[model samples]
Structures are given as structure tokens and as C-alpha cells.
Target: MRLHVADHPLVAHKLSVLRDAKTPSPTFRQLVDELVTLLAYEATRDVRTHEVEVVTPVATTTGVKLADPNPIVVPILRAGLGMLEGMTRLVPTAEVGFLGLQRDEETLEAITYANRLPDDLTGRQCFLLDPMLATGNTLVASIDYLLQRGARDVTAVCLIAAPEGLKVVEEFVGDRADVQIVVAAVDERLNEKAYIVPGLGDAGDRLYGIV
Candidate 1:
């Protein structure tokens, strides 16, 4: 497992606004889209590509195009849905999938209530869109599902993460296929209730509403 914290002033600045409790939902949603797009740039740095020849008005040149078995983007339901737009804005050709993983409030365990991904993801590169990485159970479970279905590589894009959660994912994913975590920031800690301390409140709530 590899961890990447985007290092950019714009990312930090937007994250600051996103964290403010006073920000409205409309603005919050827009920022989430922008932030995810910014983070997506870093997350897809190693995305697979193959050489291709293109004939331009000036000359023919060799370039790279997304490899076969086009990358799959899976948003982990609800909150993750908010990230889908931003991700696709960048990788418009990437295939889209959905996974409804609800974490029990009491147990804090991820449960797969729904999924719409291809059963055989052989050689497919998958990208997971989730806003927060607080406890990591959700990500670990999601990754396990993909790996089980033959996806040997995955990249998870989150707006922010907690060290404890990152550590959990790293240790849990040791030597299991290739995995990478890309985030805008790593907050201080997780509060007793398992909420990310100083995080942008509940991402799902902020994006949609208190439902």
C-alpha cells in the first residue's frame, strides 16, 4: 500500500474552506468536486497507458492512450457519489461502477448493500471515490472486493484521511496486489466517536444533507 498527500497550496486552501463549519451545502458540493478533480490528477499519475500513433495536421507522432480494459471508477455510494462528477471530468472515458457500502453506525463495519461492477475485472485498473478515510474499514472491505474479482491494482481518492486509518489500511493491505491512497490532507486524529477530528464534518452530510 502506498500513501500520497497532495502538496499544493490550492488544494490546502480549498480544503480549509471545505472544513469550515459555516460553509453551505451548495458551495460544499462544488468544492468537493473541485477538490476531487485536483486529487484525481495525482491519483492517476501511474494509470496504465500504451503507445499510439496519431496523425496531426503538422505530422504524425507517437503518443500514449489509456490501455485496454479501460480504468473503472467505483464510488462507494452516497458520499462517493459526490466525487463521481469530478473524477469523470478528468477521466471521461473511464468506465463507471457503483458500490453501495454502508458502514453500520454501531459496528463501524462496511457492508456491501449494492454493487454494479463487472464480475471479471481481469487487468482492469480500479479507482475508488470516497470522501473520508477515518476508520479505513470501508476502504479495506472495498479493496478486498475488487481484488477478489481479479483487480490487482486500485487507487483510492479521499479528500482527507486520519493517520490511524491510513496505518490500518497499510497494515491490512501488506503484500496484497498494488494499492495506493491519495488524499488532500491527513488530519490530526479520530475522535472517540470515530469521527475525524477537525475534519470537514460528515462529508456525506455536507454534500447531501442531514438525512
Candidate 2:
């Protein structure tokens, strides 16, 4: 498993505001979108492409276009839904899917309650969207779900991550398939309640009002 922490000033600027408790919900939501767009740009850096020749009025040139079996964007719902628009904004032609998983507060385990993805993902490049990587159980489960359906290449895009969470993913995926995590930042650690420390609290509650 590979980890990429975005290192741009814009990412840092927006994320600093996102960490503030006083930022209103409206501003928070806007920043999430903008920040994800930046992260998405980095996440899709190695997205599959194919070359083709194009003719201009004066000459012909070779260029690249998204390959067949276009990449699929799967946003882990409901908090993950907040990231969908930002990802699609950058890859408008990519197909969209959803996986709904919630963590058991007591056990810190992830349970899947919904799935709206293709039955077979044999050659597809999947991008999983989830804002926080705290305990990492939810992400591990999500990656397992994708692999079950034959997905070999999976990239998870998160707004922020905890070192503990990253280690959990790395250990679980050792020498397995191709897995990468792209995040705006990897904060200090996970708190007792499994929240990323010095982190923006509950992404779902902040994006939408408490639910």
C-alpha cells in the first residue's frame, strides 16, 4: 500500500480552516469540496490513459484519452456523499457508485448496509471517497468489498488520516493488490473514541447538520 499526503499550500490553507471549530457549516462544506478537488487532482495522477492520433486543420498530433473501462468513483456514503461532487467535478466522465458503511461506536467495526456498485469490477480502477481515516476499519472493509468483486487497483481519497489508521491499512494490504491512499494530511493520532486528533470533527455532522 502506498500513501500520498498532498503537500500544496492551497490544501494546507483550506484544511486549516476546516479544522477550526468556529467555521460555519456552509463554509465547511465549501472548503471540503474545494479541498477534495485538489486532492482528486493528485489522486488521479496515474489514472489509466491511451494514446490516439488527432487531426488539426494544419497537422496531426498524438494525444491521450481516458482508457476503456473508465475509472469508477465509489463514495462511501453518507459522509462520503459529500465528496462525490468534488470528485466528479474533476472526472466528469467517470462512473459513480456508492457504498454505505457505518461504524459500530462501541466496537469501532464497520458494517455495510448498502451497496450500489457494478457486480463485476474486473478491469476497473476504483477511487473510494471517505473524508476521515481514524480507526481504519471502515476503509479496510471497503477495500475488501471491492477486492471481492475483482477490483485489483483501488485508491482511497481522504481529507485527513491518522497514523494509526494508515498503519492498519498498510498491514492489512501487504503484498496483496495495488492500493494507495491519498489524503490532505495525516494528523498526529487517533483519540480514544477513534477520532483523528487535532482533526475536523465528525465529517458527516459538519457537512450536513447533525443527523
Best by lDDT: 2
TM-score, every prediction: 0.98, 0.98
Candidate 1 TM-score over all chains jointly: 0.98
Instruction: Provide the overall lDDT of each model, using Cα atoms, as 2-decimal numbers.
Output: 0.94, 0.96
- Summarize candidate 2's per-residue lDDT along 109-203 as a digit string, tens digits: 99999999999999999999999999999999999999999999999999999999999999999988999999999999988889999999999
Clash totals for all candidate models: 0, 0
Per-residue alpha-carbon lDDT of model 1 for 91-199, expressed as tens digits? 9999999999988889999999999999998899999999999999999999999999999899999999999999989998899889999999999999998999899
Model 1: residue 22 alpha-carbon error in angstroms: 0.7
Off by over 4 Å in 2: none
